[model samples]
Target: MRFLVDECTGPAVARWLEEKGHDVFSVYDDAPGIADSKIIRRSHEEGRILITNDKDFGGKVYRERSPHCGIVLLRLGNERGQNKISVLRRLLEEYAGRLPDQFVVAAAEQVRFASKEE
Candidate 1:
């Protein structure tokens, strides 16, 4: 899988993804301080699933109708890097094949897939 890790999502998660053999582009490492709109646009253009902690992206995709290859929105109760990685690990283990072109919200206990129109 290819991923665009948002700046706020941090380098640890990006590193973990890389270790898992996913092609990863880290905004924190490659392009710091970039705007959220550009991040989403770049992710779409590159055909990368965006990994972000920002709720604003829901508005961008749902309300503004922005196009995306895929998005994994982390709504974890524990925002620590390890917790994020654990949540992502579970999500990938269970739903990797179903991820593309979906808006997925991952929490500590559950994962939800939002309808594209929603």
Candidate 2:
């Protein structure tokens, strides 16, 4: 799958996803300091799922009804960097096949999936 990693997410997550053979674009390296709306627009235009730690994306996508391919909001809190990465890795490992066409909120202990219908 292709992904646009938001600036709020750590670089390690992008590196790890690339290592796992997914096409990954990281805003941190590609376009530093871009606004959230522009980043969301780019992700939509490029047909990429957005992986972000920013809850603001949720409001923009859902409340504002922004167009997007998909979004995965990582909601893990107060964890070590490595632990956060591990959570992301586990999410991909367990849900790679089911990730598309849905909005996913992945917390440390649970994952919630919502679609346009929901």
TM-score of each: 0.97, 0.92
Segments in model 1 whose C-alpha atoms lie over 4 Å from true places? none
Cα lDDT computed for each candidate against the true fold: 0.95, 0.85
Which segments of model 2 are wrong by more than 4 Å? none
Q: For candidate 2, what is the TM-score?
A: 0.92
For 2-117, candidate 1 gives per-residue lDDT tens digits of 99999999999999999999999999999999999999999999999999999999999998999999999999778999999999999999999999999999989989998667
Weakest lDDT window of 10 consecutive positions for candidate 1: 109-118
- How many backbone collisions does model 1 have? 0
